[model samples]
Target: MAALKTSTTWIKGQEFESEHDGNKINVDGDKKNGHGPKALLLSGLAGCSGIDVVDILHKMKVEFSDFSIDVEADQTEEHPKVFKDIQVTYRLKTATDNLEKVKKAINLSLDKYCGVSAMLKKNSAINYTVEILN
Candidate 1:
């Protein structure tokens, strides 16, 4: 088991700073000013799965020139809004022959490796697609 800790403190109107593992992240309620909590959560999901995919692919000897993830999520209209649906698009620049291996790596991340995905999926439905550019 692992224990993680974080602290958040208000900076100003609708803005705050979150500290974790010696890093600080600025969060704002106004989307135009900075990332809101929900948006950050979506980014976390993508980052978590992206890290997993990279490690899995490396272990499998799959090579890629570039990789990125794009995520969009729908939120409930009611108070205490939460994500309803989330979609992730993984874009990779790699050899055509590695497409199947890349997909397998993504599947492993989404289905088994990403803790962020597991937590969010308890409330949100997640779907994903892949795009390979060679």
Candidate 2:
């Protein structure tokens, strides 16, 4: 297996600049400094799943507009806090008839394709809902 690599540089006051491959991201332990680490994880989850969903939907010939994924996770209150539960809402502006197909696409990503989901699910409970807007 090939190794994935990243490096982080300190930027003072609970802030860091992380580089993956060639892309750089600002991460912070404090919200005022940059994006919180956990929140960035949530974004990664959404992005990973979203990519799968879009590709799956295209192959399924599902046309949609205003596609969005909203993620909310609850974290533990103790030290070394972790996510207890995560909820993902998938919103699609498409025909109601396409709801079933959209759901199928999401299920495929969450259950079989998304690596991030697979990793996160090992520790946190994940649930999802679909909303169709005409």
lDDT of each: 0.92, 0.94
Worst 10 residues of 2 by lDDT: 26-35
Kindly list the per-residue Cα lDDT of model 1 for residues 1-134, writing each as its tens digit: 78888999998999999999989999999975679998899999999999999999999999897799999998899988888999999999988888899889998998899999999989999999999986
The regions of model 1 sitting more than 4 angstroms off are none
lDDT of 2 by residue, 20-130 (tens): 989999999888867899999999899999999999999999999899999999999997899999999999899999989999999999999999999999999889999
> Which whole-number lDDT from 0 to 100 does residue 20 have in model 1?
98
Give the TM-scores of the predictions, in the order they appear. Answer: 0.94, 0.95
Model 2 TM-score, 2 decimals: 0.95
- lDDT of the structure predicted as candidate 1: 0.92
* Weakest lDDT window of 10 consecutive positions for candidate 1: 30-39
Name the top TM-score candidate. Answer: 2
